[model samples]
Target chain A: MTSLLALGILLLTAFLLLVVALLTRNSTPRFREIPALTRLVRTLGLSVEDGKRLHISLGHGSLLDERGGSAFAGLAALRIITEKTSVSDMPSVASAGDPALGLLTQDTMQAGYQAAGVEELYVPTTSRVTGLTPFSYAAGAMHIASNENVSTNIMIGHFGPEAGLLADISDRDYVTLIGASDNLAGQSVLYASTQDALIGEELFATGAYLGAGTSHSASLTVQDILRWLIIITLLGGAAAKFVGVI
Target chain B: MRVLTAVIAIAVGLMVLLGYFFAEFVGIQTLLLNWAVILAGVASLVGIFNLIAVHTDKVRRAEKGGVYSALLVIALVATFVFGLILQPQHQIMQVLLNGIILPVEATLMGLLTITLLYAAIRLLRRRADVMSVFFIITAVLIFLGSATLPTGDVPVIGTLIRPWVSQIWALGGARGILIGVALGTLVTGLRVLFGIDRPYGGK
Candidate 1:
């Protein structure tokens, strides 16, 4: 019965997302400014123009688990970043801690290149698995961030407190670091370590904020609607409990 | 090709999702999941080879960190060969794990404490905003609360405030973030299922 209820909710969310996506097909939606993403997008353009590399770290999040959600968002951001910077002297590189994520990142880069009509520029080594363990992953990504002439480091995925190491390198090397994570430890570590850190649901908003597609924006609208619904339900439940109703 | 890939993905995804609620599709879902697990193992091997190839190229080109790359490749290959020969359950493998891997990882974990402190200090120096101040204050209080002096715990901060802050405020905020994250996950999964957003090489 609980599983049924979960499925019902999932179906309802899917319906809402599709409806909102179709409704907003012709209309342009305005999103409130997220300074982190703004700075990231701006840095992306500058990095391309200046012939500096960009490093995206997709942490070791399993594709079969809930953690895969944030990593998928990171992949979407990577696609957009790759497409935009494919023509630059130094193309963007991505690192993943999980094998599935590593392969997917490579595929995403290839798709992005194909989309930009630069399939010849696609390099399989551009996206790879740096390390399997959390600390090792951070260490390897730190090497790339510090040594690859990368101007900006965008870390959006599942990470642990070990992310502080990468952020430390970014700070020491004077490279821009924009990071986010789904894990609480990772979030707290990133929040304290990085100057531009996306908190909570902001990590999921990467695709929408980066102009991935209208469907991405529509997903944001669905998230907003669902958030309000959840808030109302929680408040109502609390009120009922306060009034001696179970 | 993209359409076909999307169809297969969506069909498999729906079957797995439905298998959770209905018993009829559970067999197929399990079969698919097992296949995925096998594929993931192969992918890991592919990733390891890719890592070796990248480092090999670096060493060949004599890049600045080529020495480190060479060391890594040597260590990785040696480890793999030794593990395969002796088996992971062998005493030598256990000693290698306990003496080397575990200690190294533990040391890194210990390093996180200092890194976190340094970051907290840098955060204060970089941004003294309301959120940063609150974060630092809460962290300090939590640390202090968790510690005990020669005599006992601290005064009201430890006795009265810590439990409330951790159990109430922190729990509430974490729950809020979790809900938002769940909603985001749901929408993202839906997008993939509907073929609206494909990160799996689909155009």
Candidate 2:
């Protein structure tokens, strides 16, 4: 019964948000400042101007897991970045820990080039399967960061404390690092190491923030509405409890 | 093709999701999830092949790291043949996992600790914020608290700060982060299920 109620609430909220988004087409929703994303745009521009490659690591997250949400968000960011860089001579490269993710990364890169009408510039070797395990993935990604002359490192997905190692590697190479991760340890490491680190749900906002489309925006809107509802519920419940009410 | 992919995705996603709530289609849900796992395993093999092809191309082009690529190929082939000859759970496999893999991973983990320490120092240098200072202090407290003193007793300062910092403060922050992540996951899953967003290279 609880799951049913939860599902009902979610579906209704999503539908209402979608309708509102469609009806309010004339007006645009304003988002607060996201420093990481702003910095990423500048870095991408710099990479293109300097003729240096952009390196993206999707981390060691499996696409089939429940926690794969962060990886999906990472992929959305990849799509947006790849599209932007597809027209440039220094195309962005992507690495993934999962084979399924690697294949999807390849597909996303191809789609980007296809959309840009620059399929010839698409290199099949750019999107690589770095490693299957978390630490190994970090080691492989570090190897690329040090050897590939990557100007910017955008690391996002399900990472652990190993993220610190990647950031260290990037720091050693003096490469700009933009990162996001769902792992708590990874978040701590990112906070300590990276200046522009996307924390928690901020990672989920990549698609909407990067202007993937209205669906992403609508979904983000629904998430915000639900969050507000949750806050109200928590506060009201606390008040009720304080007043000796159930 | 996009339309077909979307249709199939929605059908499969809804079926499996519905099966979780209603017990009648549990078998179907299990079957679907199993199929996904099996496909993932196959995709892993394909990824290995893809890696081989990529390295082969690098070796052919005589890239800067062509020697390393060649070495990787050699190691991969040797490992694969060895694993095939002596079953995966054999003593040799155990030796490889325990002796080689574990040691390498442990070394990386050790490096992670040093890297984290360096990063914390860098954080202090770069930001110099109260939060960074607090983070460093909490980390130091935790490390000291978890360590055994030469006199065989936990230090009083470490003991006093560790529980408050780790069990209460860190746990509360972690729970908040987890709640946010759970909500984000819900939204992401809903988008995929309802076809609001598709990352399968469709549309």
- Best-performing candidate as measured by DockQ: 1
Per-model TM against the reference: 0.98, 0.95
lDDT of 1 by residue, A1-246 (tens): 788778788888988988998999898889999889999889878987888999999999999889989888888888898998898899898999999999999989998898999999987888979998998888789889988898999999999899999988999999999998988899999999887688888988999888887899999999999999888988999999999898
DockQ (C-alpha based) per candidate is: 0.79, 0.63
Top candidate, metric lDDT: 1
Q: In candidate 2, residue B83 scores what lDDT?
A: 96
Q: TM-score of the A chain in candidate 1?
A: 0.98
TM-score of 2: 0.95
Worst 10 residues of 2 chain A by lDDT: A20-29
Measured by TM-score, how close is model 1 to the native structure?
A: 0.98
* Residue B110 in model 1: lDDT: 88
Tens digits of per-residue lDDT for model 2 on A1-246?
987996687677667666866865666766788999888877766777788888999998887776588888888788888888887666788988899988888888887777777778889888989788999788878877877778999987899899999999999889989888989989989999988688888888877777777767776777777788878988999999999998
Instruction: State the displacement of the C-alpha of residue B196, model 1, in Å, after optimal TM-score superposition.
Output: 1.7
TM-score of the second chain of model 1 compared to its true counterpart:
0.95
DockQ of 2: 0.63
User: lDDT of each prediction vs. the true structure?
Assistant: 0.89, 0.83
* Regions of candidate 1 where Cα sits further than 4 Å from its true position: none
